[model samples]
Target: MSGAVQAKGGSRHGDPNRLGHGEVPASERGPASKRIVVSYGFWIFLLSDFVMFSGFFAAYAVLVGNTAGGPSGRELFDLPLVAAETAFLLLSSFSCGMAGIAAAARNAFWFQVAMAVTALLGAAFLALELYEFVHLIGEGAGPDRSAFLSAFFALVGCHGLHVVLGLLWLTTMMAQVWAKGFREDILRRITCSALFWHALDIIWVALFTIVYLLGSGAGA
Candidate 1:
């Protein structure tokens, strides 16, 4: 009779959340881990960006030849200048990877250094792009000049705008890291930024190939 009561008490008073001495039931546990939540949600955001860019790509493709008798990409694009810009952006991506590694190791100094390098390279790429735009506008190849130019500016300019936003984000992340060490949330933020920067790098590479190299070949 005593054993039966003790068993009954154990059943009633023991961890009600557990299942046969196993881990607690997931339903009773808290929300999903922050890593899964952040990464998964951010991937959705990136996919939406990809969709937007894909639309721009399609528009550019259709309108590429519809220059309204104006200059084509081959005549206007400076491959040398674009190659330099590509180098800077590619280097920035490498630096961003280094920064991510530093963040994982929780090395504040290296993280800052890598992030600074990334910012500098990204800025250089942006500066070059701005210069190219200014030169093109001065040459009367502005977006208003032709449908082709308009599409060109829209596609390339959109990417430049992203880079500008990324720079701002990078600055903010640096400030956060300085104010607070490599906290979990901050590291997640850094990871997202790195992903964003890498995405830009990839888009730029495609831009270089299609809009620069191929376009230049066509006009030549």
Candidate 2:
């Protein structure tokens, strides 16, 4: 009697809507899971990036005042221009956020518009940075001039390189979205880009506060 009842219960439990322990339900095996996994993996990558930046920051801090009779940050830094660069980057981060929102809503037009604005702002920031570098080099404050100059170039140039890569990534994402219509893979890439841009914004804030504001004697 007990054996017969157990067999009947097992048969009733084998509904198509249910799955065994080792089996993956359709909902659990789809794009939702993929998105979660991609986000997790990308976050790990971002953390590693943060670690690298932290090391750069430590080195810069140690070498910031080693001017060796060369121009110091107080003499070389144009606070107003740096403020403008910060404004542009912050605004670009905002536009990037809007782009991500538009992507999530599947509004291609707004997404494109927001991304274009972001790219433009990012370009403006990079242009200003390049101008600063040119002016410094022309003033004979090249990286080879002193330990301070070398550290400054290393720290800030690394950040600038990241911005350049970010701009390229932004354009590629735009093209991918245009071509693929925000498919899960493309959307994941967009999400990762957005995260990266925001992370850069945060890093810039720290850089500006430490290297610009304090070094300029403003925060100091």
Say which candidate scores most in lDDT. 2
lDDT of each: 0.92, 0.92
Candidate 1 lDDT over residue span 90-166, tens digit each: 99999999999999999999999999999999999999999999999999889999888998999999999999999
- Each candidate's TM vs. the true structure? 0.87, 0.85
Model 2 Cα lDDT, one tens digit per residue, 156-191: 999999999999999999999898898988988998
Clashing residue pairs in candidate 1 are none
- Model 2 error, position 112 (Å): 0.3
Q: Where does candidate 1 stray beyond 4 Å?
A: 1-30
Question: By TM-score, how accurate is candidate 2?
Answer: 0.85
